[model samples]
Target: MAVHVAAIDFGTTYSGYAFSVSAPETDLKDVEILSNQIWNSGTAEVASLKTPTCLLLSKDRKISAFGYEAEEQYADIVLDGDTEDYYFFHRFKMNLHNNKNITMTMVLEDVRGQPLPAIDVFSLSIKALKDHLKSTVEIKNIKLDDRKTKWVLTVPAIWTDTAKQFMRKSAEKAGIPRDRLTIALEPESASIYCQTFPSAGCRDIVEIESRYMVVDLGGGTIDVTVHEKIPNGTLKEVTKASGMVVAGLRLMMHLSNFSFAYLADHF
Candidate 1:
């Protein structure tokens, strides 16, 4: 009996939310998905569907800002000579996977290498996105009843059950009811989305009986899934989901290391 479905994608490098409202009789392909596509980057000419994964905390540990606003706020804080007290975090989502021994008590370091409870950081970030989405729905004049809304959170398929549970706990701590939240695998979601394409646009690609692979090259992880379309218009996984940490962020780290090594050797 849900009136709308909202999905949050907490990416390593960026994060965003999307939602759709449709009648039960409406065609899946006809349902219009709306997302936060006007993320402000301070520069008037720069806007994107997702915002940078960043957070800024005040001296007392309260959330000051998030996303692009967090970056701009931290920059101003630095100029004001009060940067020491604030905590700024970016690209911290990878810590959940990088730490093989992740637990509820895990801690994550901020940009200054200062440690804070990982659960707190994650919950706060999720809360920010959740609040933003609520505000957007209100602005659109949509009557979104929290009790009647379905929330979906996406995670990398390669994540361990513990990591996935951690996300669930974080979402709950962020005020999302446990029963209302559904955890979805990134590549599987992609496959489902592909299924909605019209035959002419996706003929032989995702058509019935077609076999294909979905490679989700994300910021912190890369996931691959093979699927086969059944005659009933459903996709069945043909193989186990697998992935690695060698993705966009990791490549950037390698490039930075190479640059440093080159400078050390030449100068």
Candidate 2:
């Protein structure tokens, strides 16, 4: 019997899944990336690589929308409405490192009193993603009944122990089994993929030493790692990496501030 392995890259801005299939030779090969594996569909065969990290709360105090639909609706509400019931926050992953000190509140007219915890909001999104994955993939027969499908989730290298623990807890609450879960540094995972390309080769003939700084500029954070390349083509970490949660999205928000002010004054 062939063994089936599933690898899930649960990113902040995007998430992806790749499966490993064992052949008759007992060798495993990674299959192509799966698409539309995370949400319901109403359109053509277009694939969704990344779902927005935003969630929409309905007047009934439930998760009314998610992913791109939530993103669109939230944008419309923020840009063109006077109603304050709807709550939306993009780049939610950046907020993970804020620890438990900061409390995010929502004062919806429908729901009385204080707002929901940031962690709860995050948990809801994580749960939605997990549910989506379970429905799309068939894993019952491949694995033993007692053993659940395993997943490898990627996180930033600079994530504190507390933050990582929080993420793991969130995953548990989202229905991901603790026994089957593994966490890999996001930059390391990206490096593994990048090293596969031939263009990343060095030029020296006899002895060559190369160092690369992998800068990951994502929607929520910017992480950079320095890797030392050895003769055998394997990279070793030399220096500690550094990252900032503030990124491109912050710049866009700054620009939007001015644009929104101008529009308000003119219109």
Best by lDDT: 1
Task: Write down the worst ten-residue block by lDDT for model 2.
Answer: 105-114
lDDT of 1 by residue, 178-236 (tens): 99999999998987887775456555756678988889999899999889999887888
Which stretches of model 2 miss by more than 4 angstroms?
1-17, 21-48, 59-61, 73-87, 98-114, 138-147, 196-210, 229-235, 251-267
**Model 2 TM-score?**
0.68
Best candidate (score: TM-score): 1
CA lDDT of 112 in candidate 2?
Answer: 18
lDDT of 2 by residue, 5-105 (tens): 45555566665556544544562224333443444324333446666565677654467666777756655655675325665544556556544443334
**TM-scores, each model vs. reference:** 0.89, 0.68
The Cα error of candidate 2 at residue 218, in Å, is 1.3
Candidate 2 clashes between residue pairs 3 or more apart in a chain or in different chains:
106-115
lDDT of 2 at 75: 54
